[model samples]
Target: MSRRPITEYAVLSDCRSAALVSSDGSVDWLCFPHFDSPAIFGRLLGDEAGYWSIRPDGETSRTRRYAGPTMVLETTYRTRNGMVTVTDGLIMGAGNRGHDLGAGAPGALVRRIHCTEGAVRVAVIFAPRPEYGLIEPVLREVPGGLLIRGGA
Candidate 1:
């Protein structure tokens, strides 16, 4: 992946820490729990650092918007054959609102993709480099999702 200017990324925050998501649907940077915590994904600094992405299978134009009054982001991809939308956010704690939104953040990231028109193939990639990209964890398929393990 080519280096993207910082301006090309969207910011998702729990009000304490934030993530940088590229226009191509890649989450190139994120740190959990606190703003100064070690990054869980850090492709923003190097290609092999890590990244998570959700996009259409083929060439497509993209557009994005933030859900009203929230840090939630919705990115839409339009392909020659169909269209799909992916939503991304750093989940705030339940009941968090207004000045307290994220005051109790559960420290989780969420991504949801849906096809609203025609049939569009989707591509998903998940590569996590824990501890500032130093630990390349072992990944295994599980019943609900992939399990990532490594590091002491």
Candidate 2:
């Protein structure tokens, strides 16, 4: 079988945790509770697995930025009729300091989207992948997000 296209994806990790944000503005890779912990989302490896993605609906051009001297990223999409921007960042610890506590806290990925220029349609897709590639996974919808269970 042919492999899926490697769509553009931005990586966000705090040395401990990591995630991949797709060109379509979807977050396809994420491990929760802890970086080494089992992945809560792993759709990047396949279509049926992974986590949620927030993106503008319809055809659109994209752009991105980071919040100055930081690892934060801002992604912007401009469609024929409108524009939408997403601000992505990792939550900082106390005193406006980075999470330099040597792998202490679990990481959080934040995505904030805003409409600019004109109204645009946005979509959110949540697909959770518990396994990497060894075993098929089960996706369960939790109160706030999803739960992926399975794999070797």
Candidate 3:
């Protein structure tokens, strides 16, 4: 299948694994628990089939960058009326910094967003896709968050 060229995306991880946050504010690609483990989010392959995303209420222009040499991503969205900025990154352990991707204890992907300029409405959607397109797994909302079952 053909894939849409991602206009922009950012990488965030807690050392064990990484997730890609799209310019639209969606976490399109992510591998949970371990980097080589089954992907918990895979919407990057199809429409609304995998992962999570965040975007403005409507169409808008966006710009993104890494915060210094860190894995923290700073994305700015510009609309007809105002602009907003989103900061996304994985919370690392003490004394750890940069895009090491392999220097922290297991942790969840942390996405922190802030409005830098003006007021802009944002939309958030979370849909996890596991096992690519082969298996249709079951979704369960656990205590902490959602979990997927099945897939070998």
Candidate 4:
């Protein structure tokens, strides 16, 4: 994974934690559970520092913004074949509202993407290097999603 300019990154926060998403739909830096926690996706620090990427396979033009008044980011990628919108958010507490928005944080990140027009081949990469790339965890597949183990 390569590092993008800080200006090209979007900040996604759930009050308790934050993640930085690059212009190419890659999460280059993410520290969960707490603000001071070790990075779960730390590519910004080094080449092998792990990352998660989701994007259109070929050349694409990108645009992104924070959805409404929340910290959730909506990034749109337009390829020659089609356009897709990717929404990313560091999930906050259930039912939490203003003044108590992050009262019961869950420390989870959610990324959702959908085609807005036409169709394009998608590219996806998931690599988790916890603790600033010091821990190479084992990834297992379960019924609903993937599981990460063998890390402290």
Best by TM-score: 4
lDDT of 1: 0.85
Give one digit per residue, the lDDT tens place, for model 2 in 1-152. 11535557777766666777766677777775457866666676666656677888788888876678766778989988898888876563443334454345534567788897788888977555565444567767877644556765
Model 3 alpha-carbon miss at residue 146, Å = 6.8
Residue pairs clashing, model 1: none
Q: Tell me, by lDDT, which candidate is best.
A: 1
- The runs of at least 3 residues in candidate 3 whose Cα sits more than 4 Å from the true structure, single-residue gaps closed, are 93-104, 130-152
Q: Write one digit per residue (lDDT tens) for candidate 1, span 92-122.
A: 7778766876565565788999898899988
Minimal lDDT window, size 10, model 3: 97-106
lDDT of 2: 0.69
Point out where model 2 deviates above 4 Å: 1-7, 92-106, 131-152
Clashes, model 3? 5
| Regions of model 1 farther than 4 Å from truth | 96-105, 138-150
TM-score for each model? 0.85, 0.72, 0.72, 0.87
Tell me how far the alpha carbon of residue 141 in candidate 3 is from the true structure, in angstroms, after superposition.
Answer: 8.0
- Report the number of clashing residue pairs per model: 0, 5, 5, 0
**Root-mean-square deviation (CA) per prediction:** 2.8, 4.1, 3.9, 2.3
